[model samples]
Target: MTNSKLLEQFRSFYFRNFPDDMETQINYFSIFGGLGWDVDTSKPLTQLIEELILQNFDTLNEKIEQLTLNEPNNKRLLSALAVGDRKIFSAFKRAGLNNGNGGGALNYLQEKGIVQIEYSRESEANKISKHRISHKVLFTYPFIRFWFYFIYPHIREIKEKNYNKLFKSIQNKQNSYTSLVFEELSEVLLNYNLRDAQIISSGSYWDANMEIDILTVTDKMEIYVAECKWTNHRVNKSELHKLEEKCLKLGIKPFQIILFSKRGFSNELKSMQSKDLALYSSDNFEALLKNALNSTLIKSFIN
Candidate 1:
């Protein structure tokens, strides 16, 4: 239901049914996973969208209309949140709302479990000012985000049985859009691997100046700082250095610096792996395919 544990559950369900290579599974899951539906990954996502969504337009509209109380403002806000950065201020800005009205609409959505606000916490020991650290507004499910991002934006075009705009937006934006899903699943993978660790907390870390994709701390005070590079190029020493610089500024002496990429690491970084450094490519995600391992994930990690 809620994304509190939604990413992990969708991933589990996907691997169970799709039975594809890691790359194919992740690519399709980014667009279609969060609705608890059985997706036919053989079809292109655009075809699937036409078959499942465009043909079923009135049905979806009825469903969302019920959820949003038929308010255009709420729909506008949801579309903006999905298409843009998850920053709270940016969502309101893109939706063209002042705080009072926008804040009320956000509260209503939060109450309905459609979205939630997550604040960036400053390290108590840091000297940096905390005021500029931004909060994010995230959808409760990936499918809802996908709908708003691709379908909701062009409902009028879709109404005329035209799909050109929808298809174009997806083709152009898919990689960047799916990058967020990859990052989410990367966190899920981390939590699964560290199932035995006494993890105190885990998620994205941000301050005024920088955002770190994956940061996990254990009860032993061990910190793992990671970057998920969902790109085509192999990761190198330079990526590692960037993470190091951010940690240095935050005074975070991590137990390990982890890097995950779609493409594997360079020979230089590969040789540099040690107790304090780790590199992961999508191939490493094959670990998530084990039913025995994931069945106990939330139970082990959550209170």
Candidate 2:
């Protein structure tokens, strides 16, 4: 499919599945003056949210505070009292911390049992801490996160009645925005094809020293290092060389290398498509998603 067509389908799916997020984003932004957290109107929003975050902690001495003090029963109130709510993350991002406040809020939620965190068996290079909202707050938290980070900023355009341009911008950059989701999806899909591939453990990993998108460790200790590219371009050999050198410097691997692209592989790398080196394209990915999401042919596909 053409990139534009692909993006349209994805956006349709996202909106369909996440209608609440759309509503929340619109509502929040409208209330806070177009999601511009730096604006004067947002000052109250930030101060109020920081106070909420502070309520979750007990005077910095580490004593557990009264969890019931805020609303005592309302999930929304509890979320408001916690540190990593949409408001706080917005404040942090506006202050130039980027995703820092969002990350901190998520961590806080995990600590409060309002959400749960899990670690996968995927290799150290790719094993990421997967999070799920506790059943009580599942529908609410993700929508809140999506609102403040994804949809809120676009509020300005919507207010100015520039929806066509807003939608176009979202359409053009959708893949890059959702790249992390696709990377995780790719790892889950690859497991079925790796039966004879000596994979001891595989998962999404990220840390200070190493920042691999995906890492698969073979039983024989060979490491498969991957770089997932969501852009519309062929995967070239230089990227492979870069990944190979990175793995070598980390003191691991008679490396198995794979370059996964949303488009396809470059001509220079096509000749090397073998067991040891591999390239996967967007068409292949669509098939994987179809097989998993359509008929349940792949029972192990992670949603």
Candidate 3:
């Protein structure tokens, strides 16, 4: 299928099968969803999911082999990437690869569409300059991200047929693994749901000292700074204060501060919500999706 058509299919299937609950949705898709799998609803869910995961694992192995053959160090670069949700060129260098070689490998992966670059847009002054810009590398898909993060490092165990160890490792890190996906979903919500603000630039911002989960600048020069939490507990005032402190340290006076939580907010934060502060839960994400659909339909009618 064409790339656009494949993406449309992926989106339709994802939205239909995986709804608002971020953790549960990612868990379901990590096993049962992919490009070529024929999901059999009649089969036992556990049995079907196991089979789908194995099928994806086999496909991933094939891709790894191809990538390694194309570039001997590609697997190493991927291993470094799988270490976390995102990293810069220096991270790979520190992972023991030569800096020049690591950069080349990253460039190759980006060219091959295996990795994506999140170009930093932190405004130093009034004008944003292209020179001295840095970026973080991320896996382009959730399945790939999961595989690399949890499975690829344990290839030796898989080759020796020690599946139990791999399963245990994945189980231990499952929550941490899905948190990155939650952050990406938060970005989508911000893009679609921000009131009166047209996003001119948006992404995670980081430096040597700290990192902000979500940051955006609107066409009108208003800044929206946000933090995303994928925890089971409600977000509290301390977390909001931390975001406020970070923005202050960066010399940014945000027009709005957004707190996105999977489990809603604490009473203190809920009481403090106002025009300048916004709290979003999983339910708000569902509403954002509905709003997006309605907006699309209205645009179609107007066009």
In terms of lDDT, which candidate is strongest? 1
- Ranking of all predicted structures according to lDDT, beginning with the best and ending with the worst: 1, 3, 2
lDDT of 2 by residue, 1-303 (tens): 012222223333333333233222222222222111222222343343333222322331121123222321222323332223223333343334435444554456556544433233334444346632211122112223333333344545544544565456545655554454345445644654565666676755434344566777767777776787766567788888888877776666736677777667788899988888878765554433233233211111011
- Writing each residue's lDDT as its tens digit, candidate 1 over 162-253 gives 88988999989888887887887788788777888888788888767788998989899999889998877888999999999999987789
- Give the lowest summed-lDDT range of ten residues in model 1: 294-303
Q: What residue runs in model 1 are displaced by over 4 Å at the alpha carbon?
A: 1-4, 123-130, 292-303
Q: Considering only N, C-alpha and C atoms within 3 Å, which residue pairs clash in candidate 1?
A: none
**Candidate with better TM-score, 2 vs 3:** 3
TM-score of each: 0.88, 0.51, 0.80
Candidate 2 accuracy as TM-score: 0.51
Could you give the C-alpha RMSD of every candidate to the true structure, in order shown?
A: 4.3, 14.0, 6.4
Q: Compute the lDDT of residue 145 as modeled in candidate 1.
A: 80
Task: Judging by TM-score, tell me the better candidate of 1 and 2.
Answer: 1
Q: How would you encode candidate 3's per-residue C-alpha lDDT over 102-202 as one tens digit per residue?
A: 88888888776677787766555633445444578766555556566766787787767667777777667766666766676677777767645676888
The alpha-carbon lDDT assigned to residue 125 of candidate 1 equals 62
